[model samples]
Target: MAITSANQLELLQTAEAVAREKMIDPALVIEAMEESLARAAKSRYGAEMDIRVSIDRKTGRATFTRVRTVVEDDELENYQAEMTVDQAKQYLDDPKVGDTFVEEVPPVEMGRIAAQSAKQVILQKVREAERDKQYEEFKDRVGQILNVQVKREEYGNVIVDLNPGEGVLRRNEKIGRESYRPNDRIRVYIKDVRREQRGPQVFLSRTAPEFMAELFKMEVPEIYEGIIEIKAVARDPGSRAKIAVISYDGSIDPVGACVGMRGSRVQAVVNELQGEKIDIIPWNEDMPTFLVNALQPAEVSKVVFDEDAERIEVVVPEDQLSLAIGRRGQNVRLASQLTGLDIDILTEEEESKRRQAEFEERTKLFMDTLDLDEFFAQLLVSEGFTNLEEVAYVELDELLVIDGVDEDTANELQARARDYLEAQNAKAMERARELGVQDSLVEFEGLTPQMIEALAEDGVKSLEDFATCADWELAGGWTTVDGERTKDDGVLEPFDVSLEEAQNMIMTARVMLGWVDPAELEADAEEDAELEEEQEA
Candidate 1:
């Protein structure tokens, strides 16, 4: 068949018809042809093959010629099998074994099968070349957005006609509320590029988290230039998103800078996201404060971090629970992902009950630590002293100056108070137990000796505190994790379960059914009490 530009165009039209009949693109056929020709040339002439061919504009006549290396070779068996001396003379000087020569090989049509085979080879080559070209074009644009025209829909997915080629914009990547028609212009972020048997495939997205980041870069100069840094982002895609941003320059307010004058900067991003709500939060090094800020519009009361579990528990108001959790848990989910914390949400009522129970548990512990022999802690209920906080916060001198107390008595009382406070602390461990806190101990930090005693004073005490206390307040009050104390220092290593979990096991063992009776325990306690009283007496 004749090959030329005019004929090629005619062939293109015919190929398009063929492609359409076969449910394929004519461009795909052309790519395959180019690839097949290159491969055939490479194989036939070796690295010395530099054959050049072009189709005539009107005739469709594809002229093929051979370009050969000027070298000497005798038996060119496998390479250029038919090289006449006259043909070899044109390209070479002194001919010998292993010498090279060039000769024009006429384009021969063996039969229809051979023609078909050549067409198939060309098609295959086109596909490979297209894949390589597409991979190169899109790999660098992985996280960037490109404007594309909607070409066609297949199996609910839209194929976008990009300038260089085409790409698939999966259904999931389509904005939830947006609809598209053929030829509609839309901006899509390049999610991935894959090389396939047919050609290079482009994957596009409209809902990825980086979509917002990319839009921000386009809208805000500060972002592209790296003046303002987007520390992290949490997105619900088509609904709402929270981004933590910080600026290296003190003069620039990161949030305001991103927001632009009257919300211009963020508005551009929101428009790209199809009216999605955007919340720009100021990033903080302080974990607690940052966590609270991240769960915005929900009014977080506190955040508790469990170092060993690498988790955070957020306390919010009862009404704000759903808001904090968001629809289908999007809020907390995004926040957890952004902060790299496993977040657990708690309501005010639950936190309140837990706080009360924790209070009672600590009081019982304080009572246990008192020197039952030399002294005893008398509950000062009449004076409104319910927990240790009332006691710890009160002036030591003032406490000693109370009626029935002198300076000597006061000093002794202070020492006793301190000891009682220390012993009440569940955080304290003997040298053997000093290794770690229990693995099941989620509220592993923030329980101060004073807080423990205070809780005890409130009639709150025991493992019940462990069971009921909200992680936030527990984390806020004191610390249980060991090692370095500063934020600048990296996180402490997790406490080993073998040593730490023993404390929880002991509590479990004591709570089982085979335990002694309270009355029997009271009688035994009375005997102990008698001994203590005698020692004091």
Candidate 2:
């Protein structure tokens, strides 16, 4: 094969045909041909020669050239492609070190082996271009629903044809034991589009929670029009699911719109999900209220939310315990997912018993620490004094308000409580000193003696050590691992330190130790405030 006038037009024709078949740009195919021709030219000429090729997009003519760059004597490593500045004077009137010399070269005549190698190069380039086209086409289509046809099944994974591209619905992404034969049309959520070595991989999923949301968006006109928005969705695919929706228009009920007239809209989505039952709940700004709606078909007596831990405790009637938990805890699990909070469901009786136990524990603390009798301790506990610190520091009027407690009695009670707290603090300070706690940490202003002792026990004995600690490390936090939230115990957590307090204390320690500049912090805060103002505007 040769680049002759007869075959020059044929090159462009072939490029167009190949590009049309691959659904890629014709220019890409032409560029691939040029690269393959250049590679072959290098083989025909010296391997060290810098050979280049260009194809005219209009005339379909191939141009080949040899290129050599003039460089400094010491930098002229490639004798065939690079020349010294003096050596290039013959080709130019005045050539600099960085000047390039180019001359036209005859196109290579392709032999059997060369032609075969060029063909492989062109194929690889075309395949790469095709993959890039597919990736760019589908990358933004993620979280969307696509109607596709099943091509085949490899192992348990179903391969679906996405018209111009192919997608794989992994076994884990399928709803239940969904089995498909060739040519089965199905709707799937475009979970991800990834560029891999083999090609662009379009991962499809039928079990994703977003799939249900998209389905509703398609089935409900209000959702599609943005009159109602899907706030959250949780699914046990091919089984039960919960969807929370909010309506921007007051007249439009999001739940009713999603449910549709006579259950037609939701039924469409359910049929597509292989009979997955869906519970449409009205979305609420209040987390507890939303959670109550999420755990439907069960009555909630009370909800206790621990915001720092992102956990919630729900007290239901004894008979509703099983209903709230659902079969095998699926209801609670889905509700937790829907609300983004770890949930603990308990019966009313259990909550009452726990509250009583807490009350008794507080009563005992008052009796032992304040040296009060059982009845007097109970009275203090009932008056909302949980610890000696509160009793010691509380207003005298608050203690006097208790029935049968006079101002003198309140004064005496506060005095005894303060004495006990001081003694406990002195003992804690002694223990901390024994454990090598430094005065820098002890006199940090925010940390009490008990807090210092806890820090020392946890190997944080100095201000420097405290400065290096993270806020979560000192205030305790919940970590989500494998989809389950686990508690991380903090040294200062026992002192009732909040995350914000821990952050402030650590920053203060860092400033005191000269590890952080207060001025820089203030500037950063001002910049953040300005950015927030701009965003609001």
Point out the worst 10-residue segment of candidate 1 by lDDT.
Answer: 486-495
Model 2, 53-169: lDDT tens digits are 999998999999999999999998999999998999999879998889999998889998888988999999998998899899999999999999999999999999987879999
Best by TM-score: 2
Kindly list the per-residue Cα lDDT of model 1 for residues 1-537, writing each as its tens digit.
434344556755655565665445566665455444444554444545555454443444555566544333464443434454455665667544445554555543334554566677765545455566667878788888888899888887899997668999888888875678899999998998877766778899888888888888888899889999888987777898889998999999999989999998899888878899998998998877888888887899878887655678888888899999988988887787678777889987897898767655555544654342312344332234555545555676666645566677556655766666566454443321333333333233434444334444433345444444343323322233441122211111111232234334333434433343546756877999999999999
lDDT, residue 69, candidate 2:
95
Cα error, residue 489 of model 1, in Å, equals 28
For all predicted structures, in order, the TM-scores are: 0.53, 0.97
In model 1, what is the error at residue 486, expressed in angstroms?
Answer: 30
Candidate 2 Cα lDDT to native: 0.93
